[model samples]
Target: MNRITTAIAVLVLSTAAGCGTSRSATGGAREGNGTVTGIITLADEVGPKTGDFCAGLDVRVTPTGAPEEALGNRTVRVSRGRCSYQIANLPSGGEQLAFTVKPSPAWQCGNGATPTLAPEPQALQLKDYQTETRDFRVSCTAPSAETSTSTSTP
Candidate 1:
């Protein structure tokens, strides 16, 4: 029964995703811009060490060649060590777009230690009428002694 219910829920979501391409009175879709869903995970090397804190990441998306007045909001915050970013109401013909990931201020090992961070920003282009997913690995350095040492006594 649970499996059946899960399957039904998935079907509904997929169906809605396929058909939800119109503007509405609510804040979902205002145009035919399709949705993009994905999970942002900690780089393999940066995980457990950094506690796999997803909230420590920042994301932003912007359409290229957009008029200054046409600027729109595309920033998303990671929740529960993951993120599901969706850029809606995007103009269909917009050729290029920008995606950026900025690690949060707390993305550290603590104790004034600066965790190694990704060297460069990850960017992605936009494709209309498509669902897209992209994964990025941020480079990071090992935590300093002060931050890496455990306080528990043996």
Candidate 2:
């Protein structure tokens, strides 16, 4: 069922991406512009979900040129521990799009104690009718020492 849901999401995104170019912040398309879809994979050297707390993530993406004006600061969301996150309908032929993985204490990307995105805001070029993927690793950090006890000792 989980795989089905994720697959559905990809389908929807692909459909949206196929319809043509993305509209500006004002909801208008630019001539000769294209669309781009981005994916953030959190599977690099990471453990399985294993019934861990699945936490959704918010991603912030901004089109390089005229960022705030054209594309604005758009935030995308994905299911908790979801391997693939699709950010679609971005304006192409504009500027290099920058992607930032929002931070969450519950999810750690690597061995870092702070649990932050390694490179941060992964960037890419936009193209029409195509999906671009960025590989990343994320893991849920251990709880505090107080919470590590498996049983209460009276």
Alpha-carbon local distance difference test for all models: 0.52, 0.52
lDDT per residue as tens, model 2, 1-154: 9999999999999988977676554576532243333444454444334453234455545655544543433334454555345555665664566656664445544543344454555566666654555655553354567655587779
| Clash pairs for candidate 1 | 116-140, 116-141, 118-139
Alpha-carbon RMSD to native, per candidate: 12.6, 14.3
lDDT string for model 1 (1-154, tens) is: 9999999999999989988765444334324464444555554444443344555556655554432322233435465555445555544444565655566665544334444434344444445776566555554565557657577878
Q: Candidate 2, TM-score vs. the true structure?
A: 0.46
**Candidate 1 global CA lDDT score:** 0.52
Q: What would the TM-score be for candidate 1 when compared with the true structure?
A: 0.45
Give the range where candidate 1 is weakest over 10 consecutive residues by summed lDDT.
66-75
TM-score per prediction, in order, is: 0.45, 0.46
